[model samples]
Target chain A: AQSVTQLDSQVPVFEEAPVELRCNYSSSVSVYLFWYVQYPNQGLQLLLKYLSGSTLVKGINGFEAEFNKSQTSFHLRKPSVHISDTAEYFCAVSDRTSTDKLIFGTGTRLQVFP
Target chain B: EAGVAQSPRYKIIEKRQSVAFWCNPISGHATLYWYQQILGQGPKLLIQFQNNGVVDDSQLPKDRFSAERLKGVDSTLKIQPAKLEDSAVYLCASSSLQGGEQYFGPGTRLTVT
Candidate 1:
């Protein structure tokens, strides 16, 4: 079985400050990792994904994540965030053998202050 | 392009009652999925469909939950004799291929009193 763990339940940051949401996964086989953002009353939007390329992956809204296989981590980072960046972020993992299923972490709530 | 669409944005039902939600996937999408998201928790996959055929439903509550995708485009999920634990946002998502980046719908919030 595959599982995702998000260490932080909530993260508070001021506008234009850097932010990092930590995520770790446990899987017996190779996996695909992804980050998704959900604003209030909206569905989740794909932030970025690590499929088969470089370790570094860039996503929308100026967010990026690095897939570290040794550490089993895919942490999302933003050099600078805006007020609008306040949202709930999720980390998901899909086993390469059974790609149809995705296991998501609890989620990290990013609260951006002025 | 339009994203995945779900109907009955909000639903309130009593325990022991039944409820249903609908979803219309993006045009040309070959895969559709249904997920359950509890408050403060990440979404959990309940079922998956591959063009009107069942692919994976291992996690779905077979006794109380039922879902179908007809014509390979639209799908419906129903819960009979709902329980308080079933009160959550039901999300619908679609993807062009299996294991691809999925586009999610706004989700239908279900509250069982």
Candidate 2:
């Protein structure tokens, strides 16, 4: 079984400042990691995913995340956040050898202020 | 090119009432999924289908929830005798294949009063 943990429930950042949302997971086997962003009254949008290769993966909207195997972490980061970046972010995981059943963590709400 | 599609973007029903939601995956996608997202929480998988075959439904509350994907493209989810706890956003997502990046539709927000 695989489970994800997003440490912060809410993060407030100033516009143009950097931000990071922490996420950790527990799995007995290799896993696939993903980040999704949800705007008000909208569906989830894929930010990026880590299936293999380099630890750092970039996604749309100038967002990125790094997969740290040893730490069991996949933290999302943005060098400069915009006001439009304020939204709910989710961290999800799926076991590599198993099916594509994604297990998501409690979302982190990002509030980017001017 | 188009993303996953879902119908009746919002619904309201009394407890013990029944309701249903529908979904249409992106063209050529081979997998579909149903998830429940309660307020203040992340989405939880209720069921998964690969083409028209059931893949996993471990988290589904069998007594009240049921879902089906017919013809490998469209799907429906039903909840009978809905409970107050069933009030949440029901999300539908599809992927090109198993373990691939999924695209989601605007969920149906079910409010069971």
Best DockQ among the predictions, by candidate number:
1
TM-score of each: 0.98, 0.97
Each candidate's B-chain TM-score, in sequence, is 0.98, 0.98
Which 10 successive residues of model 2 chain B have the least lDDT summed?
B94-103
Per-residue error for B41 in candidate 1, Å, reads 1.2
TM-score of 1: 0.98
Off by over 4 Å in 2: none
Please state the error at residue A17 of candidate 1 in Å: 0.4
DockQ of 2: 0.83
Report the C-alpha lDDT of model 2 over A1-114, residue by residue, as the tens digit: 889999999999999999999999999999999999999999999899999999999999999999999999999999999999999999999887875888899999999999
lDDT per residue (tens digit) for residues B1-113 in model 2:
88889989999999999999999999999999999999999999999999999999999999999999879999999999899999999999999998777889999999988
- State the lDDT of candidate 1 residue by residue for A59-99, as single tens digits: 99999999999999999999999999999999999988877
Instruction: Give the winner by lDDT.
Output: 1
The native-contact fractions of the candidates, in order shown, are 0.85, 0.90
Deviating ranges (above 4 Å) for candidate 1: none
